[model samples]
Target: MSTVNILHMKQGDGEMSYAKNSTIQMRWMNMALPIVKNTIKEMLTIHLTSFEKLESFKIVDIGCGSGPNTLLFMSEIIDTFYNLSNQNNHQSPEISIVLNDLYKNDFNNIFNALPLFYEQLKEKYGHEFSQRCFISVVASSFYERLLPSKSLHFVHSSSSLHWLSQVPENLDNKGHIYMAKDCLPIVFDAYKNQFNKDFYSFLNKRSQEIFPKGKMILTLLGRSIPEPSSNDGCCLWELLAQSLLDMVSQGLVKKEDVDSFNLPFYTPYCDEVKEIVMKENSFDLDKIEVYMCNWDPNDDEDDDNNIFDKKKSGENIVKRIRVVSESMLVTHFGELPLDTVFKIFAERVANHLEMEKTKYTNLTICLKKK
Candidate 1:
């Protein structure tokens, strides 16, 4: 089976859909707003100032996943461009959008959302918005070259690049699905090598596609420290492993199945990202920052470690996880154990949170083509 077949988020806009559970993803995108706003202004001043408004300006969203936020984010970005252009007394330029992702991504959901999305843009910017905006899709992988040479301006992505092209070879990550405390040296080495290789190739490809001054803002699930096994980085999987082990004890899941599975996901440290960018040498690292959010996207735990209503928080976190992971998990563990494993996972998460607070850490990386 294809990788896309195995890795898509839950489809539809139902309660359990990525559309419903993407508050965390939206928050990550919104956190990049200050940088995004600055980028648009710079693009307007530097590039659009010399061009005819009738000419098309292209932007690409690499790994633009499904959810209501898919078009919502793109529309807001266009609005930013036009609004900033208006401020500078420039005519509106045709905005061409290229939405690229794996084959099985829920492009249908994104397509269904378009009428309303266009209406919202009309509501805000009127009929002119319709003429100035163009949207297209390339059903392919970012790990391969997806666009023409120097064909892109102001590229963007979020919660994407951390996914390796494939799972690492020869994982002996028995009993754990990801990097964790006490994970063997070989396991760590496999993950590190895979990420390094995939990421360098990704940069080399993207470097060719973006214009000389084109910028990319990539936000990913990542860590504040260099260690992949750190609490904020790998604790989520460790907890998931504990839940799977509990299931094994109950005979609800096979011990061997639990032992052999490992996620194709990695959350890199800021320094790790810096080294890769430096090694690639195709882009200048403008800014890279680490930010933390509560594991429960909706958690208002405030400045303290207080997690009131632990059970509710646990459900929230697990539901968020389920939307992203359910398909691959069901394929590996079968549909029957789905609810049971997740229920156990939620309980484990609540208990773990009760002991101490752990926030999800992420990296927002900004780059300029060199």
Candidate 2:
């Protein structure tokens, strides 16, 4: 699909809510931010920063949800320079940053929170802090609108690339007879297409904008082993679909619609990503490593855990199977009267465990410009 068509398709999903008072989303963000921040920091230390002496730096956090990652890096750069000079009683280096996301992002909350974050830093570091640094919010898609390419020193994004403009065209679930077998391929093609279109544009654009030797550190959902049939091994998403199926049985919607209802998300395999990047010829594969990130806990520990353990082993199996379903449920059904829907979904998951088992693993990619 064309980028314009994809943007329009995303519009139909409704606006991405940016309300600060949002509670459930806040809970989810609270769980996600720290993990993402630490990972970015770790990647920077291991892959991006090679020399100690520094000069002016420009950094960007794409899909910078809420700005914690952006703030973390900025603080780290300043601190690194300060510590290096601390023993010598010298000056700190200067840095400028830009945070970008879709124009529809909740800039109100970001603007409100930024001044405070800015003040805290300025107070400790003195007036020079404000002079050398800048933080501005840019509104654009990662596949498009990032300012002056070769201008950035470091670019990072986490957990955001998997969403494409819309479901793949061939898989459109407007109606189908053999959805069970056809569903996986349709979903895969839609994701593959989105990556091809968006990332291709992303590479071509970045090639022109990024300066020689610049780097992009991207962490997103990817297939662990390139299973043409598996959906990033996300059994939860499948179960969530089953829940949609249940909803249909209860007269909520049509079965034909269910078959055509492809997920609006896609996770790329490591090799697929490498192919796109290598094909560009402007980015040399500095270091590409794919490791498994396990987000599931095996313990029966909290209120959420209680739900997982209370079921019979048979029921437990379904809950286990729906791990992907649970994630999908949380992704979309999180805010909806979760109280009862969660219970029904959990029960269905437990009952279905007899048929399948599921697990999820993420892929991380690190690259540099040619």
Candidate 3:
């Protein structure tokens, strides 16, 4: 199945939901706040001066999964506008916010939270500000067009663009779901080619929807190292692959099943992202920065001695991995193995972290529609 059909964050606010297990993403969002704030400030300064001529200011959060983070973004945008409006004594333009994610995302959760979201916004920014904001959801992949021509002024996505529209075709890495240190060269080529195609398509489509000079901010998994299979870049998937191989050894899962399964994901290097953006020729790259984040950002509970708590750290990482990947794994491996597989996967991650702290490089980019 295509990722568009199957890939979605775990739904709802329950223990296993993406909403519950998204602290890492929350941290990423927080990291991007300065860029978001500055970008909004600049956009508003330039675009809102002619507020009388505009119908509404449209901002979109691409791949906006359910819950607090999505609503948090809405609040941030409104608050930014509120502050700017106050400074200029300008009436805030009618605001239109669209949240975009895969077709399978739990938009109902977002919609259901609207009452509380608006209530909080009203309390924070007053009824006039809240009343001016309108919210909508679009269930679609960002690789494809999600809006009309020249409709959006700002687009923001965090920790989402790493997902390709589908797994690379004809992958033959054998037992690996992602690039590995010793994978055949063809495997690397296939993955890189897929990302180039998907990313170009994403840029091409977005170019049609955003007005000239509109801003797009994207924060996604990436690599600082040049090697595609570097441990820092692919260690999470490597450990997950090892866990699956362990199951294969126990006769719990078929070897062929593991061999055939590949994640519809890729983490590009900073230069790779720049290359594609330049090649696409649709958006001007404004800024790109890479940052490293721990596999478990909430691992501060360690003792003064700094002994590694394998189980605690493993559980934290496990919750995050499970929330983002359970749907894909369950689809490929059946629901029976979900608990067992991740249990093994978590233990393997713990062992790896015990040996050396594993970090993921995140790439944040600012783009302007050309």
Candidate 4:
């Protein structure tokens, strides 16, 4: 299925909405903020030390999912400039922040919150300063160019790029929604090839939109090793697959339905990312770092590695996955079996965690246009 049409986060701001279930993405956003702040400081010192020539500092947050985080980054950027100007006595430049996401994403929530957010900004930096900040939301696919040439200053994205434009054409990945330990080599190759193609297009298009020397910081699901079926890569999916198979045994779902499903996602190795940037030749790979997030987002105590409550941990993990994947699953599996399937999935996740703890590795890559 095409992600452009069929894929989206569960919409609205209710308990089950993506809005309420995005703590993991928010965590990554916080982790990447220091990098963003330092880059903004560097840009001020060199490129836009003075806004005499450049009137506005323009930024686009590609795949900026709707939620509390929608405006959090933008607010931080404004504060960065506000603080710098106060400390250095530099003139504050007008700022523009664009939020880009798939058309199916729920944008109304963002629209509703803008007025109050703007009001709060007015209190922080005064009315005139707030007036200089512009906010726009665009519904479009990032695989294609969604901005004018040489118009952007910086780009930021988190928890977005791992989704391919679509499921690879003619994939025969049966009995699994994603690459698993027993997945065939042919299936793995198809996924890798699709990621290469999609990422190349992404870079080529960004090269057209961003000004020379502009930078982008992207955070997405990734793997530490080259193997696609490794623990950090596919263990979560394998557990979910086990849940589906259990339902198959109960006749709750068709075996054929389970067999035909495959996700439009891929987590690449650091080497794979390096190779792609070199091949594209449009961006300089500045740095790549990996951070391990537990399958349970709430599990953050470094000294505590034990799962005291396996059932709660499993439920927490499934909530995160469900907010993001529910749309696609409903499109493919119908609504009747979703609750039951996910209940079983949570149980399987709990059982799996009892034996071993696994994490999702996120790769944060920094790139600058060459």
**TM-score versus the correct structure, for each prediction:** 0.91, 0.70, 0.90, 0.92
Q: lDDT winner among the candidates?
A: 4
Go through the candidates in order and give each one's C-alpha lDDT: 0.74, 0.51, 0.75, 0.76
The digit string of per-residue lDDT tens for model 4 on 248-302 reads: 8998888898888888889999999999999999999999989988888787656
Clashing pairs in 4: none
282 Cα displacement, candidate 2 (Å)? 1.2
lDDT of 1 by residue, 118-161 (tens): 78778888797576777777777777777777766666667776
Flag regions of model 2 displaced more than 4 Å.
Answer: 1-55, 67-74, 84-90, 123-127, 174-187, 256-260, 295-341, 348-357
Residues forming the 10-long window of minimal summed lDDT in candidate 3:
1-10
Between prediction 1 and prediction 3, which has the larger lDDT?
A: 3
- Residue range 257-277, candidate 2, lDDT tens digits: 556555555667778888988
Rate residue 275 of model 4 by lDDT. 98
Q: Which residue runs does candidate 4 get wrong by more than 4 Å?
A: 1-21, 47-53, 303-307
Among all candidates shown, the one with the greatest TM-score: 4
